[model samples]
Target: MAIICRNTIEAINHLAFRLDLGPDDVVVTTVVEHHANLLPWRRYAKVRYVECNPEGTFEPDAVAGALRGNPHPKLFAVTGASNVSGWLPPVGGLIQLSHEAGVPVLVDAAHLAPHRPLLAAADYLAWSGHKMYAPFGAAPLVGPRRTFAMGDPFLAAAGRSTWCRSTRCSGTLPQSARRPDRPTSSERWPSAPLPVPSQPSGGRRSAHNEHLASRLRSGLGAIEGSRVLGPGPLVPTLPVASFVVEDVHHALVAARPAAEWGISVRHGRMLLRPPLPASLARD
Candidate 1:
């Protein structure tokens, strides 16, 4: 079963709430997740992070260890790919491992969706459409039917109401069924009349991205003061390379290109804030 959401963050929060998580419950997740995936779980449960190695990668054993340590983890929240390192985890095997341990898995595919086929085998999946060049404000949350069938809606609003008895009200089955008004985005932004650029096939795009990433890594490595983060391009990854130049503030590094060449570069923490694993370091 699936339902539309205002965005991937909302979808994640809804999933977290529906899990019936609490302070006593444990959630096993990795260190390399985006804040959207991590914060929602932290709000309701005690999160056990499976720390990454220096290369920003973790083995199934690490996750297994986390599960064993927790004894009865309610869920395993994991990223399909790292937005910072561009590293793709073995999500299929990870999902299987969690299932074998009697834990449900939620695969945060916000970054992975635009690059590769999704891990459909996972118990729950969530991703944003904007990453794939679709308009913002639309995301999808897909999961088992029974989970959402009987729960009180995450956002108790007008559209979700099934019945009203003076002061008491009931919500619809598949809680998000009436919540998202995604179609309104098109209507609201009709003035922005343009289509997304055409793209190559998935296989072709992936290959091109890999080649481009390799060249980017090589160029950055040659720069006298620059240091690229994560494993080398020889390691399979998406077309994302983060780097830093010695004796330069990241803001200055980001500003020079946009001012001089009209090339916008993102800098700063990229949302991997403090209290996170050292391996998932700031770029």
Candidate 2:
């Protein structure tokens, strides 16, 4: 899942940048993002943040309202699940809202790659394949051909690749294995990134995550103060849970070595910027 584009947002832009999209192309996204998904689209466009409910699940109607705020939102972004809370959002209605407004919807499936169904209801979807039992460094941008046609040739020519950073990619690679007279496509496109190595996902990792989900639910059974968030029959959250621990700092709890015993996890607001205080993260 190597993201060859400069970033996930760049992948989105490269996939849809040509439809004469402009600064006025208002974009709507939830405050909860992986930074990779939110930054690029917001960088070149107006981004409206949809608020999450108290339980951390996104209010689908708020997203619909935001899309209605602008005359025609060029794009809408949302997470398949909160990286922090492991909450899958109400995507169907949100997609409907954007479509009703003639806007294209893009789901940041980075976290959901390990949880939710891959292509639920987004017009232009972005995800990290590396997260989906694939090798590190790969990501995916899935969209219909019509949506992909928005890509601009200039963006392509600029050689803006997310995973490709070294000048060697844009320049020349003398390490070419190609014969002197043979010019291969991979040699020509030095930045060509390979997606995560295809692996048979139906294996121990799957069983392990599934077992973790069951164990977590059983452990939380009839808890006096805790409540589950998002859809019921919880569609396989990644060996991760986001319940509150009274008087406990999530950061500290997440940092505890015990967390590694189950599965390594990060704890915080899924949306990195809007809710986090300056002190929590350095500028």
Candidate 3:
């Protein structure tokens, strides 16, 4: 079952509500996740971090190690691709590992949806329509129908009449308003079904993205003192690259080029870093 939400964050919040996560429950996620995937869990469950390599990559063994002794884990949430480094983690292997432990997996596909296909192994997928060339205000969470039925309603409004009774009062209620039958499968949620589009022939877009990513990485590598983050150029990734130049602040790197040559680029620690304690930062 899928539900339409205002954004991916909203979808996550609804999923959290459905799970009825409590203080004892734990949600296993990676250190490379965006804040949207992490913060929602903090509200209702304990979050366990799976450390990634310095370049923001992890394998299935690392995930298995994290889940070995944990007893209260309810879900395993991860991102399909890194928004900053564009690293595509081993999602299929990770999903298999989590399922072996009797846990469901949720995939945050905000960045990957635009560049590549998502794996069918994921239990839940959350994505934004704007990322895929559509207008804003269209984000959908696709998952099994049983999951949503197990939780509270995402939102309550009129016309969602499950069982209505007629009371003898001064005011007369119309019979059409007294719907006693249970809602059908399609009418169980607030979100409407998303339209399915035609699939691309032969995956031409994915091939093009890989070719461009290789060229971008090669060009960035030639610059002096440039340190590229995440996987190497030949590895599978989105057509995005992030690098830091020695002795240069990221803000200046982003500004100077756009002002001088009209070349727009993003800069700064792109929110992929894990949250640090204030005391640790002071040290």
Please tell me which predicted candidate would have the highest lDDT against the true structure: 1
Q: For candidate 1, lDDT tens digit of each residue in 155-226?
A: 666655655577766643355453332223222221221223476656887898788778878887898999
Candidate 1: minimum summed lDDT over ten consecutive residues — where?
185-194
Clashes of each: 0, 13, 3
Top model number, TM-score? 1
Candidate lDDT (C-alpha), each: 0.78, 0.57, 0.74
* All candidates in order of TM-score, best leading: 1, 3, 2
Better of 1 and 2 by lDDT: 1
- What does the lDDT come to for candidate 1? 0.78
- Give the alpha carbon lDDT tens digit for every residue of 19-62 in model 2: 45556676777876666656566546666778776655667678
**Minimal lDDT window, size 10, model 3:** 179-188
Per-candidate TM-score against the hidden true structure: 0.84, 0.61, 0.79
Stretches of candidate 2 off by over 4 Å are 1-21, 146-214, 217-239, 243-252, 259-283
Off by over 4 Å in 1: 165-167, 171-198, 269-283
Q: Which tens-of-lDDT digit does each residue in 1-283 have in candidate 3?
A: 6676767888787788778777778888888888788878877787888888877788788788777656647999999999877888888888999999888999998888777777788999998876776666667788887676532245543344433356432123355443222233433232322323564433777787777888888888898988888886668788898889889888897898799989899776655355665422221
**What's the residue-level lDDT of 149 in candidate 2?**
28
